[model samples]
Target chain A: MTDTILSHDDLTARVSRIFQRAGLSPLQSDAVARTIAAGERDACKSHGIYRIDGCLRTIKAGMVTLDAVPELAPEDGAIVRVAAHGGFSNAAFELGAPELARRAKELGMAALVINDCTHFAALWPEIEALTAHDLAAMAMCPSYSSVAPTGGNEALMGTNPFAFGWPRENTDPYVFDFATSVAARGEIELHRRAGTPLPEGWAVDADGNPTSDPEAALNGAMLPFGGHKGSAIATMIELLAGVMIGDLNSREALDRLGNFTLLPAHGELILAFDPARFSAGREGNAMARAETLFDAITGQGARLPSQRRFAARKRAMAHGITLSAEEIAHLDRLEERGLDAVA
Target chain B: MTDTILSHDDLTARVSRIFQRAGLSPLQSDAVARTIAAGERDACKSHGIYRIDGCLRTIKAGMVTLDAVPELAPEDGAIVRVAAHGGFSNAAFELGAPELARRAKELGMAALVINDCTHFAALWPEIEALTAHDLAAMAMCPSYSSVAPTGGNEALMGTNPFAFGWPRENTDPYVFDFATSVAARGEIELHRRAGTPLPEGWAVDADGNPTSDPEAALNGAMLPFGGHKGSAIATMIELLAGVMIGDLNSREALDRLGNFTLLPAHGELILAFDPARFSAGREGNAMARAETLFDAITGQGARLPSQRRFAARKRAMAHGITLSAEEIAHLDRLEERGLDAVA
Candidate 1:
């Protein structure tokens, strides 16, 4: 059940070719391809090339327009709205991040809300773009229904993922990204594929009982991270990402299965602020101080959030990404078909 | 061990007189008193008038200056860094909230960081103040160490409470305030005083073993809400309130606990934003939309966050606050001692 990794260049080329065959303009295809490649580079495998099949499915369904560009509404001074008009979330973010970063630099802090975009992959790329530009950034998305309210048996909340990045003086920006649930549904999917048991307190069976069986958990509801507190935090995020953006909640979108044509209308909110505006040399100092305190508390034993992903990415970059035989076979099939479409 | 509640006016006047007798200026005393009374009005008993004795203790120890006013440091766009110089948090927020709210009106957002203030009672009033001005507000405070990090036995983090408020069209502003821990230390104290057992999983004994005894829990560590997820959220707030503001984390401040001459360098961060800048009628619409979705979910037998506090505040406002006989005796003793000090 192990997944195979593809070479970064090979993956990027295939992604670009797939988008081009789907009728995407050259620039649009390049942007989408780079976004997917960046996900692989960051080791966000769930959101990387794994999503290519889904994106292709969406394009074939006519749910996403390969040539459509986001429409910016009239706004002023540190705020912007993008009506994605059934475009790819990756495409919308690629088009919006730089402009949002530029506006934040000019205005001190800026917020961008994107609506009607189809599936978005990993959120870290947008945060990375902002952090690279020396800005502190945060982004949130209301995902499809999967998690349950704190005490309830039924699934009524999306995983509701959030990502925040802070600029560091010498090192990579401190980035934190997580779902409100105890574990993401993708992890559950991984466990199911591997025939592994789910962890206790992570999910409940359909009859509202906790279970260690991955299949039962998958057919049931995922638990929020920290009981009622996590529930409250998830609720706050939902209000911020769904209600504030005038989109549908997870419960309302439960009927939308894997079909991209029935994708739920969730919203994304992004905020970027310049650390220099608030503190002169404080950004770096703050990160150093944080690292010191974190180390003290962790004391050679603490694991900072996202440390593993970054480490994996570093290793993979040094030695090209390795793919298993099965994964390579799958990619070869896709490549053959892609070439046929191009012909 | 029951507590008493006084009429809002009576408590405000008595608290004001106590501050004046402690050498506070009349205006500052009134402002501080009102802030404290607001906590009682909102049923945050631990952070309400219960802290008057502690405030007096700090003042008598010469740790808090009765008449110190904060001065703004040079900065850009609606951010004020207040050098508290050992002032009370209530006083700092009373002075900073209005100023920040006024600036947010002009700039669409503003923040205030208070550096060296003494303990501030409930954060609701300050958040409510911004909502009163038709702005969204958030407040956070990093206190001295009191709770253990998730999976750790040491108390390495503060309860690190946060509060947020949003102004609605036809209803009271929706306010959400809670400590990040599984249960606040105050709840443990309440249970200990009442000789009651705590619920399981709420706390741990000194050895990090789960304990249901309130006294043992008090001597041990309170659990972070939602395991690692709650831990991550608390860590983020600690960075925001502590490192970002140039202050010490709770674990760092433990050494100076009984040093009367030194002020605890915990920090507070307050942010105010005007939703109108993002969308026309967004202020009211945001709140209304949140209420609608919240009602829809909760109507089918789900409870909303802070509903109990909202109900309690309403009941107390309508039927008048009642104090228990023991609480009245304590209040009388406090007043008598204050009169003796003045004499």
Candidate 2:
């Protein structure tokens, strides 16, 4: 076969069907599928169809509640609480985002707290959801305890991800999502599979000694980006999103799961700020002012984060997402065999 | 030649006298003095008495208002606004911190916005202020446009400072404050003064090419920490704390000042979160849960941020702060001749 091309909607529908057949409810499957399709559309392969097997593994292992109906708690002053009930975070985020935007507009700023969720999606999706409402937003969450804190030997903190977004008038919103670790665990696993040496500063061996051997790194711990500063940020995510939300932190999540093969269950914190409300009596228009800043960055040839992803998204929208024969075959298998196709 | 020692109160009084004599109002002098003293007590010499001459230089250049009382805008939802009237940000922060704490408790979260202020102080003091109220807090502010965005050759952003703090029940709050840049502008300047080579990756020359010469680096642009991730965060600070607050961004602040010798006038954003309110219906106590995370960090031999500073603070409290004879002589001259003591 030459290749397969599908529109964004078609891709989403296909992914949703696979999830639905694998036992996920429509509420969870549709929301989760939308994010996976977005990943493919944006050409972020790491988060794209590649993630389906891992998610299905979690489902088959009973680590995720496939039929959960995420519920939003009653109004809680400047806070929108969503009980994910051990389900995927996507549906919970969708259930809470509208209220988050409304509360932020009303209070100048507000936070969405997601509890008891199996979270694995990129935070940018949630960030973009808020930015679509013309708001600036930030989100963070902890994952498996695979990264060591700066100056520590063992893995204690997760490769926690932090994301932020700002709204724009007629362009894609400015968005960035990144792991605090110097490199992702997946990258190390890839290196191991290729029998390649890992990059320096990417990891430490079992004794916390620096190592370039991918195998040693896998048996050891990943390092945080930018050394101590990044480590501090990861720790902050653990405190704010995990501990402060009264949910499982990275260590607790990892301990509960017992292995990294399954998705981790934890809490997430998303804060939204209404630019108009924040700049109510200020001198300049907040949106226009933001444009000026963006111009200065791009004017100097400094590429803004997420530009490549947006470019891919534009192409996908215009032409359609292209997949190889193998990928299509895998999708077909997933659709046919459901959970059995994963493990 | 022996070192001189003085109690924290005595040191604060001495710094206050110098500022008062140099034409600052008692309101501004006292608040600024406290910060300076705190810096010394915490063994942070870079932010200690060393900053006095810089503050006086800004005053001598007629860049700071001598006796402007910061005004607090009426309560507007979750925002507590303070107009610094072109004075130092210290007093403005003092005026709004309590209200920020109160509002955060009432609404689960709140923001303190300080506008039209000359800011040169470390943000940890402000973070500590909120943490004292048993609230988690974060603060960010734009400075002179001296750092380049990642992938850009020119300086289009500031070495923006980002600070965060979490309250602890029986000890110093967890806090971390750092510049987004790889190294501080002051560090580069010191290297130039000492005729030392700049560290690799710290900066680029005028042509945007990497340079190790301190002089060339000073003339060029400083690079951000963690590459693009740090650049994105610095940009976020400019948008949220600068443009969104209706105040000057790094470029505007630098342009208005015309030179980097004086402190940049801009805005500051401080967000306060009441953990008690955030974790109200959750299972565990937020404070106690935070301690568990801290224990894990220490147990693994990974030092928590600010531990060294807290150690210094303890020493200072027990034995007073020690200053070299030359530092004391400089203080005496500043006290005797006021602004005339410096060039």
Docking class of 2: high
lDDT of 1 by residue, B248-276 (tens): 66665655565322335466888777766
Query: What TM-score would candidate 1 get against the native?
Result: 0.87
Model 2: lDDT of residue B164: 98
lDDT of each: 0.71, 0.94
lDDT of 2 by residue, A274-303 (tens): 989888877888899899899989988888
Winning candidate number (DockQ): 2
TM-score of chain B of each: 0.85, 0.99
Candidate 1 per-residue lDDT over residues A1-343, each given as its tens digit = 5767667787788778777876766666776788877777777777776766766665665666667787776655456677777676666776777788877776567777787777556677788889899887878877777787766666778888878877766666677888888998878888999999988889988776888888898888898887766776677667666666665556544554452224455568887876565444343466677777676556524356676677877877887676667766756665567533221
TM-score, model 2 to reference: 0.99
Give DockQ for candidates 1 onward, in order. Answer: 0.35, 0.84
Clashes of each: 2, 0
DockQ of 1: 0.35
